[model samples]
Each structure stands twice: as structure tokens, then as C-alpha cells.
Target: MTSSRQQYIERYAEYAMEQMRRYGIPASITLAQGIIESADGRSPLANSANNHFGVKGTYNGNYVLADDDKPNEKFKKYDNVGQSYEDHSKVLMAQRYQQYVRKLSHDDYKGWAAGIKKGGYASDSNYVSTLVDVIEGAKLQRFDKMVIQQMNAEGKQFGVQSNPLSNNKGTKAKATGMNLPQSSYSMPVQRREFMLITSPYGQREDPINKGKTQIHHGIDIKTNKDNVLATENNGVVVGVDHRTTTGGGKTVTVEYAREDGTKTRVQYMHLSEISVKKGDTVNAGQKLGVSGNTGTRTTGEHLHFGVINVSADNKLQWVNPAAYLAEISQKGNLNIEAQHNGKNILAEYMTAGTKAVNTDEQTPENWMSKLLGSEDAALGIEGGGDKGLLGNLMQMFMTLLMLTIQMENKSKEEKMQAVSDAVINRHIDISSFVPNLKSAVLSINDKGNAVLVVNDGKKEYSHELTNAEKNSISNILQSDSDDTTKRQRIGCIVNAITFSYQASNNYEQIEAQQQSQQQTIQRR
Candidate 1:
């Protein structure tokens, strides 16, 4: 699959934030500009040379000539994307733009966006609108909130300590009442207090075969409870089986889909009971079943938590669950608005230099209340009726989901156009389904599986296709193969899904294009 705009945003968000913290440029502006200039790091200029910002200068004496330039203008090249980000920041420090750079607040993205255009950074007249469009479409202004949180933590602005999510206090419940088997291993089980890790993921000496090395796919955590809780979110129970005689006795597998549609399958082995069946949608922290020593190959009672990656080819490869957990820990949960303190920061930066209705009460809380209509609305979620923090989090996530769907639909339209052009020019015969394509919808699930939903005027039919099938369809469309009835149907369905998947945006590239179009309009 092509790199989604969201993927690019995520990839560069940290680097941009780091640069913002160091320099005075707004992180949001930097990110929006990066998306606009680099096509979310997919443009030929960015991919070939790592020149994300189109900064024209020598970086360590390396440069590349522009393909479209009449005089073959040299663009700065960097050894890595990080260097490009660093140079992008340094370029703003140049004398021409130094006045705006010095006067503009780091959080004032709108001012910076307007100022950059006014300072003649780009010759385009619609630079302001292009930048604003990107910033609004992707909600890039959230980075300002992130920076404020960092600043709050570092500066102790409000005497606020660590946020709730960052703190581990009282989160781990004691497994004392469950009467789990006692073991010498006393290391802290991740996200669990009383539970202990008896075995870790990696190559270890095999118990079944003495002196031989074997891969331990997951970490073994001992718990006496009947139901095992999920560690991550968006879990769907995919597989469940009873295997009393095998080493992995009575296993339950749950598949999780990341925001980027990548799938991770987590298996819980040696279960005494299974509560969920296949296809049951489960949430994080939900109980699956009881843990026990039910397998024939087990030495003691423990839950073998294994993580697996489902490849595009439908192959299962085991990965270290501990590593996955650690990576996620650093990212933290963005849904917790209180932790990030988004409301206060967003209000302060968004309306910088504006006078408030009540000058005396112009604090962060007051600003949030003024913007959101009430203190409760700012602290809580509007229209969600006070479901508390978790409820507010869910509401925020729903908004994000809605925005994602809209962006994905636009992306799918673009992808369909590209693929349609390719199919038409190649003389591929999909006439049977081409005229009726409007009634059909295609998408790739987080598991990398293709799903085609077809509406035949009266009834809607949904078919799940494998990666191999999708590839076959792609091959038929691209190759000069003779069209059979089956091949034609397969070609249409697969091509639709292929285009949709390719079109799926994390909203980064589409935002870039929005900015690009603005430049085009200005040039005209």
C-alpha cells in the first residue's frame, strides 16, 4: 500500500515538534508546510533527496537539480529526513524572514502562516489559504497543544504534576484473591502489579527439547484470574481453539487494527476457559477468559501472550509483545484531552493578542470556557452530556473517526480516477462491472484483507477477498491477459479495492494537494 498522509504526519510530527521547541516556528505550520511541499514525503524531490521543504542550498555539499526548473535550480539534499527538518528550521532564521521569525510566537500558527506569505517565503499569492487549508483539514493545530503540554511539564507553569495517563499509580491491581500459582519470578508484569513474568519473548533454551534453542514468541505472565484482560484497544476475536494435549493449550487469538489499517494478532495460550468466540468485537481491558495450566507441555500455570503480524500475503509472523507494548507506552493516549490540556493551549494560541470579554478573568480556564461556552464544556465534552473523562475521550475519538471517513472517501475518489485512467488506457475489459461500479464499494480492513460491498439495486452483497485474490486482480488489470468471465469480475473487484486502499489518506497528502492547488491558483 502507498504511504498514507496520516503515516507521514505521524512520522514527521515528532521531528517538527522538536524543531519548533528549538526554534520559534510553529510546529503546526512546519508540519502543514512539510505536507504541502513534500506530498507527505512521497514526492520525487523528497523521496530522492530527503529535501522535504524545497530548501535550495547545499547541505554537507550535496544538492540535486530540479526536474521542472528551466535553469535546473539546485535543491539542498540531506543524509536523512531529520537533517531536512533541521535545515528547514534553520532556513527561517535567514535575514529576509528573521523579522517574522523573531516577532511571531511559537504557538501562533495563523500569524506565522500569514507572516510567512507576507515575508515573501513563497511567490504564490494563495500561500496563506493553502497553509490554512492544510492546517484545518488535518487538524494540525493540535501540535501546539502538545508543545504547551511539554512546556507546562518543563516550566511547571500551573504547578501541575504528571498527567493521569503518565502516572502508573493504582492502575495495577493485586492478583492476591485469585490464588494463582506461586513462582520464584517476581518481576513486575507489564500493566499488571501482582502478576509476574515467568518467561520472556526471544530465543531461549527449549524445555521440550533439551539443549536446543527455540523461539519463545510471547511473554508468559502468571495470573490466577479466569478472564484475561486485553492490553490494547480495538481488539476483535479472530480465532479460538481447544488444544489440551498440545504445548499451547486452549488458545484465543485477538486481532487489533492500527489507525493505518495494519493488523496485529495477539494470541493468549494455556487458558482454562474461553469467554469469547471468533468474530466477537472486544474492547481494551475487556476480559477474554480464565488463565490456567491446561496444556500438556506446560511446566506451570501461566498465560503465554504472543503477538503476531498479518502480512499482505496472509502469512503469520510472531513478534515480541513486550517491544510493541513499550513503543505504545511512549506514544501515550491522545484521547485523554485533560492530559494534553488541549483546550487551554488551543484557546491561548489560536486567539493570541485578542482582547477577552473579561480582562480580569482572562485565565486559561476562562479562555476555554469563553471558547467552548462553559467551563464544563471545556473540561468535559459538549453534546456528549458529561460522561466524564472516558466519555469525553470516546466522543473526541468519534469526531476524529468521522473526519477520517470523510477524508478517506475523497482519497478513494482520487484513487479510482487514477486506476480508471490506467485501466482505460491499457484496454483492460471490465465492461460488465464498469457501468455498475457506482453501486459497489471496496475497502481493505486492518487485517490487510480486501472487502467488496456490492449493491445489486435491491440486495447488498459483501464478499471478503484475500490478499492473493487482490494481487491476481491487479495482475489481470496491468497485464495483457485474455479476459475470461471470472477474470473480468475479479479484475473489476480487485481493481476497485486496490484503488481505494491506495487512495486512503491519513489526510496528509490530500492536505498537501490542497495547498498545491492553492499555489497553482495563485500562479495562474
Candidate 2:
């Protein structure tokens, strides 16, 4: 059987050979580096920006922000994989690598690999060995020989005019421009909380075999056996396997039609249960199976997610699964709207802001009513009237006051713990109040007042803390606690406030309906 790695090499071998003919870089070395660096051309950089070589710096005024040695590092973006291959060649033609380009035979892939690593082309300590392994294992040198033979047949002198910038003084060459394409894709897991990539794709030490490296064809997402695995896109199920004792136990493979009219297959493996079978059409975010550890090959419970590109001739080539998910996530193709019992109320609330009020009364009861958006439903009272609203308000006030007094004499860390406990006891789901809430940070303003900054995966919203609230939070901020701890404490407080407001808003609607019914009874 032709392995996926071989299919990858076969798909891009022509491009590698072309580079060899034009730039004197060995086809074997080019192909080997591409396979390693780009994860066989399925890396996020490769899929999103056609950046197969992981080349950094600007490319024709275009770049993609990705995490590498650091967060949000800028990398060169190419119009196509061919442009990436061409640029990779140009990068190697720099003055530092001129010795390999001019001195070594084009077929000397081993020498080329060692020379490139010596020139600091890659940071990997075993880059040369890995490249040689890939080249020799796949017999990539044959492509180099074919290129040389083709040049001889065409009456062209090999390596004579290979360097396009041989006369240039600089050590590096500038990349030329090309038109780029945009991608809009989706992830297999819609919920961000369960979408953590436990084991990323590409070459890593085999989990089952100690110290032995293997090319992982897919990514493994951290998930429980009860979590329902969802389809990443609109696709038809093409294959299903239910081998519980062997490889990918109970897998479902769905084939999605790309925007460019090509087909791509996504496999959800090690499923505890399969919800869809062969020929079933599934929408994005539609449940496909329950994630599990049914497969003997798995280390624990997780979704073994794999993505493959289907060639026109029906050849399958494995691509990076995380790259596929990231492409869709970056483009906002996944409908990750927050839901509470099947209702999209959180999205509606955040988008519409606070509800409107109609009353002109300025009394204490009315003031609480206005803040809560109802006369009798200020604090979960159905029709308890003013006395009920005041009672609830007093109860809440006393609770907060007592809590504050209790924490006043405690250490800042202890105070934070108490606040966290209070927030947890409320059992508030922050996502129920703010749709796609990413983070919330508490900071002191220039005026020494507390301000809560919130990010809902789109934009930021600032909420100033009341005097009482500020006093409670100020000590925590001034403590030696880490930023993460501070953020968590702040988030707890914010969640409590948000949950209270939402509860009041919900109760206000109930009160309005009750008022309508009472008026009808009175008229009757």
C-alpha cells in the first residue's frame, strides 16, 4: 500500500524537482524539509497562507500571524504552494548557503542537508538527520536524478544559471508577490472548552513506544467519553468502521465539498457511539458520535480527528487536523453561539444591550425596579409588590455586607477565595450572560477605582465597579497574586453581577405577563 507520506511526496515531488532544476537545491532535501516543516503540507501556515517552509518575515507585503517561537509571530504568506516552493529556493540561495549551491552536486542531498543545517536554516538539532531519514526512506533522490536527466536531454547546462541572484551582495533575497486566496472553514468540535488539541499532528515520539518517533497523521482532542463529537462542516458520510477491538474503533468519515470544488474527508475516530452512518448528510456542528477510548491504539479517552485532501484521481493525502480547525475558526465559519437550554438568549441579550424602561417614578423601589427592569420582579419576586422587592434587596445587601465584613479582616488571598466561593455557590454560567465570553480582567483606573474589562471573542466592554465592590476587589489586585489568579477572581465577581442582572431581566418578563393577566381579570 502507498503510505500517506508517499502520497504527499508524490503530490509535491514535481514541484521539488522543478526547484532543483532552477536553484540547484536537491529535490530530496526540498521534499524532505517540506514534509517535516509543513507536516506534509497540512500545517496551519501551509493551509491558510500557503507557507509550506515555515518561512518568516514579509512576503510581498503580506503575512499571517501564527504562534511559533513566540505568540502571534508574523510569517510570510504565499499565493500558492508553488510560490512557497519558489520562495523556499530563493531563501536557500542566500550568501550563507551559497557554498552548498555552488560546490555540492545537485544529487548530493546528504551534503545539502548538512550544509543547510550548518548555515542555521533550521533550529532543530537533528534537522540534518531527520531530512536524511526522510529522503533516504522515501528514496527522494530519484526525483533529483530525473531532473538532472531532463536538463541533459533539453541541452541545458546544470547549475550554470541556477542562482537568480548570484551577483546580489545581500545574504537574503526578497520574495516576489502573488495574489492570495482566503479560506473559511470549521472545526470538528464547536465548543471551545472541549476543543483543546491534546496531541498535535506531525512527527513526535510515539506514545505507546518509548523513545520511538512516528508521524502522527491526526490530532487528538481532549474530551470525555460522554461528549458528543460534532461534524465540522456540511458533508456526506462516505465511510464507517466499527472495530472496537482494533485500530480506530467506531469511526465516521465525512466528505466535505470545498469552496474550490475539491473534496476533503474528516474522520472522527475512537467514538463510543456513532450517530451517523454511511451516506448520511450532516451539517456543521451536527452530532456525529460520542468521543471515547474504544480503540486499542488510543492512550485514553479522546477524539482522534484526522483530515485528508482528496485528489481529482481519488488519491487520499493526510493533512493536519488542527490546521483545518484553525482555518475555520479564524474565518468564523463555525456557529459557536452560546446556548442555554436550546435558547440563544445570551446572544440576543448582549447584542440588544440592557432592556428599556417606561416608568418615570424615582422612589427607592422604582429605582431598584428600573435597574432590574420591572416593578414587582426586581429580585425574583413574581408579584410580591414593593415590600417583596425591598425584602429581597435587603437580604442581598445584608449578605454582601456580611461577606465583605468577614473578608475585611482576612488576607487578600483569603478574601479572594471567599469571593470565589460565593460566586461558585451561585452556580452562575458566565456564558449564559455573555455570548462567547473569552476573558475578563479587573484593573484599577487612574482614579484608583476598579474597572472590569471584558472580551466576548469580538470586542471589549468596560464595567466600572461600585464603591463597595471596588473596596472588596482593590485588596486582591494589590496583592502578590499572579495575573491569572487576579483574572479568575475578577471573572468570578463579574459573573455574579452578570448572572444577577440576567435573572432580574428574566423575572421582569414574567412579571409583565402576570400584570397583563391581572388587568384582564379586573376588566372581566
Which candidate number maximizes lDDT? 2
RMSD of each: 26.9, 21.9
Per-structure clash totals for the candidates:
4, 1
Model 2 C-alpha lDDT per residue in residues 1-524, reported as the tens digit of each score = 14668768856776676577677788899888899888876789988998889999889999999997899999998766777888898889998887655688889888888888888898789888888988888888877887776677767665543322211111111111101124334456545322434455554567887865554677776455544544444579999888898778889888877555567778888898888889988766677888888877887677788777665555554555543443443344343332111122112212123222222222332232222222212222234334422343333432332333342466433443333322212211233223336765444333333355666564556677786775555555566876556546755677676556556667988999999999999999
Model 1 lDDT at residue 104: 62
In model 1, what are the clashing residue pairs, if there are any?
6-506, 226-289, 226-290, 227-289
- As for candidate 2, its clashing pairs are 185-328
Runs with alpha carbons beyond 4 Å of true place in candidate 2: 1-77, 80-83, 86-186, 190-194, 331-524
Output the TM-score of candidate 1.
0.33
Instruction: List TM-score per model, in order.
Output: 0.33, 0.38
Model 1 lDDT tens row, 298-354: 775667877666644454544445434433322332111110111111111112243
How much lDDT does candidate 1 score? 0.55
